[model samples]
Target: MIEWLLLLLPVAAASGWLAGKRSAETVNADSHSQLNSAYFAGLNHLLNEQPDKAIDTLLNALKVDSDTVEPYLALGNLFRRRGEVDRAIRVHQNLIERPYLSSSQRGQALLELGLDYMRAGMLDRAESSFLEVLKRRSHIGITLRQLLDLYQQEKNWHQAIAMAQKLHEESGEATESMIAHFYCELAEQHWAQKKAVETTRFIKQALASDWRCVRATLLQSSLAMEKGDYKRAIRCLRQVERQDPDYLPEILKPLSECYQYLEGQDKFFFWLTEASKRHPGCTSLVLARAAYLQQRGEQKEARYFLIEQLRVYPSVEALQQLLALGVPEDIEAASEPWSLIEEVASRLLKAKLNYVCGFCGFGGKYCYWQCPGCKRWGTVKPLAVGT
Candidate 1:
């Protein structure tokens, strides 16, 4: 690919530089001839669509000069890109073991080796390698980032938070969003272990880190509901609207439960109506409002609301919910409507992915805190109803 060609450019330049420097030496001609032949052979292999062979030949050619670190680094990267982690690790480790390498070169090799270990699923080794690089204060940002990833993979939220803070300090990049997710992870762990106080503490930490973290708000609401504090739960759920309305659908069912428990259906309906006014044609809000209207014995109003919303932004889920309300009591009339609704609902359900990763466009029926495709945290969101 273009990346491979770019990598080879440096190798070619370095080879030329070495040949020029050795022009006065008695062994210069022989060295130049061998190096030039090998370089051209590698280029020929690459052009012939034999990248694997080219990479192997290039690496072998570079191994002849242990003093040349850049070529080894490039070859190691090539191996990593080709998914040959073991070979990449071998190349980097060999470079690191050389006493002739400068401090910076050694550090670079360690970093690459750590990445190789990570790609090979050798997390423990990768962690230790990165820690060694961090101790030398070399490539601070990259080392911290890799450490954060390792901690996340290991589910060690405490370590992840520490590394994230270090990364923020070193790179001057805001890590609060990721730090908030780390707190959320810790909160989930504590909640699962029935450590209520610790869970609450972690959720508070999450909110302190990033007030816009919808996960923290949702967790807080769930915890409040579990404690029989429906008002607090409803209040917490409502915070999500101001924080990020993109996640409003996630709160609807839980909000309904809180209202039903508190006998505040009318208040809930009022809130839904206000939300629909603000976010007109939002499929979830519109559908919820229609359901509330139908429950109030206003079938005509519910049907009218559905028709208006469908005209603006048609949704299979909205249509299905509308049909559920319009079905008649009489057997014959009900049968036809039910059949039609069933077909539409089936099609809608088939098209619906409950969760989608905003980072990588990966869709699934279940939520993932870390995207499976992009390996990013807090990127997956509930799929919009009309989408």
Candidate 2:
């Protein structure tokens, strides 16, 4: 109540000042008294904590003149901040309808109305209001940002990309990463439709926007594999290691498939060995190496490698590898330890989220290109399971 009274102070003072100036010119003492009485009655209602009644009294008492628009805007914003979207919309709509409003005032009212509509979940109305502001070329950056959010929510990637481009051009902020993701979304759509040519084109566009886009590279590899181009698929998958080693886990199975198709078991071993050396403590690479060693009937070698790696990494996945490499004799002797290890590993693996949003620290088992908490793109990263 006190806060509302304080907020109304400026309006009351402004009305008094305007009335006094007009009174000197026209001597309208009777109208001035009525206005002053109405102002106090509104203030009294606010002080008594009758907010709704106070708002009504103030709205009725306030004139939509040049001087009053600022207070009206502030009041509407206050209502919006209070989560009273209906009242905020009423105030802003009333302000916008007044013919005496300045251009900037009208633009501001439109922006507020759009925000109210957004809060009310009237997205179509919000979009229309924002579009009107966009057409006027006022508040272009903010309007474009809101429109981009709307498009993103609606999954209209083309419109999102267009708005992001406009924002990039106008603000000189690098939105290429976001644009690349948008293109990747379109690429996924094309891939789902089996439009190979268009999918390839969109993937290329994604790469053009962000040369290090791991998703694009992954899609390209998948496309190549679909076409029976094993060598090309391997090349595309290999690019992911350089682009973002965090996504190396995603490529392992696919890369193994390509190697199998090419009948390049030796080459696959060599590459896995090299990768393990470069990316030390990588659980996926270590597991792949262990599998290769076991396949080659080098059980002792695989056990030694798993033990050596586990001593340094101390990860649940590494422990699993160690257990898998155990000899039949050791299995009986180590049965209890192995069971406990398995239980602990299962719990740890379950507790660990695969992806975490860099923006808001929101961790999830599944990946989200845009964080649900912070709504940022490319912020969620694959959590390193054993490294």
Candidate 3:
């Protein structure tokens, strides 16, 4: 309320100046007198701590015209910033209804009114206002951006893709990554519906939009795995390492599964060794290599591999796996202390976030193609080991 009062002081001053200007003119002396009286009545309401009445009185004193339109617009924006969306809507609506506003002024008023409606959670009304502004070819850039946001919020990926393409054409902004994510969204929807052809079509569109889209490649790999084409799945999974090595962690388990289906653990171990040497920061790749060594009856080699990697990448998961490797093969011979320590480490690993958003610092146990915090596509990646 105090902030509103402070903001209203300048507007009140402007209103008074207009009233005095009208008073200076010989005509409408009585009306000017009434305007000044209304202005003071608003100030009196402010003094009495009745801000709502004060706002009402002050707005009533100001008439919509070339001079007052800007002040009203500023007031509405201030209200919206203060979370007073209804008041902002009323003010902008009033300005929009006036007959004397220029095209630009009316467009500005509608844009602000659309923002007001969005803030108030009236999305349909906001969409209408934005579309009207776009239809008028006023504020085209901002209108397209707002429409994109609205369509995304509604999960209307097709409309979002169209709006994003138009925005890209108009501003030369790089929206390919966003467009790729939109296609991925559509693909996932079709995948859920068991529409393989539709899913494949959208996935192809995603990769065409952005060849480095790891999500699209992952979807393609999943589709291949579903069709029992392990070789094609392996090929798609390998593409991810080149496209984004940071996502190597995401493909390790799936790669192992594909190899298992092919009875090619030796091949998987070869790829793991190369990936671990090339990207040592990814703890999962290193751990997978160690696990493969252990599975091949090379316990000592696996232990050494884990110890070497743990020195460089201090991961809770790596530590837990190392501890498990130490336990004897027979349950009867298992050391009680080692088992307890391994259990504790396993708990700690589960508590850690495996993925984090590069844009917004949002951390979660699962990977997300679009960051839940920043809502940006392809910004969340596997968290690097050792913080």
TM-score winner: 3
TM-score for every candidate vs. truth?
A: 0.82, 0.87, 0.90
Candidate 2, residues 57-108, lDDT tens digits: the string is 7667656767678878887888788888888998889888888887777888
lDDT of 3 by residue, 1-387 (tens): 577678777877886787668667858778788888988898888878887787788776767777678888888899899898888888899889988788889999999999998888888999999999988889999999998999999999999999999999988989999999999999999999999999999999999999999999999999999999999999999999889888888888899999999999899999988877787657888788888988888998888888887787878877877887765565544678777878889888888888999888999988988888988889999875333
Better of 2 and 3 by lDDT: 3
Please state the error at residue 116 of candidate 1 in Å.
1.4
Which scores greater on lDDT, model 1 or model 3?
3
Q: After superposition, how far is residue 100 of candidate 2 from its true place, in Å?
A: 3.1
Global lDDT for candidate 3? Answer: 0.87
Clashing pairs in 2: none
Cα misplacement distance, residue 160 of candidate 3 (Å): 0.5
lDDT tens string, model 1, 254-314? 9999999999999999999898777776788887888888888999889888978888888
State each model's C-alpha RMSD to the native: 5.1, 3.2, 3.1
- Model 1 residue 297 lDDT? 90
Error of 2 at 105 (Å): 2.6
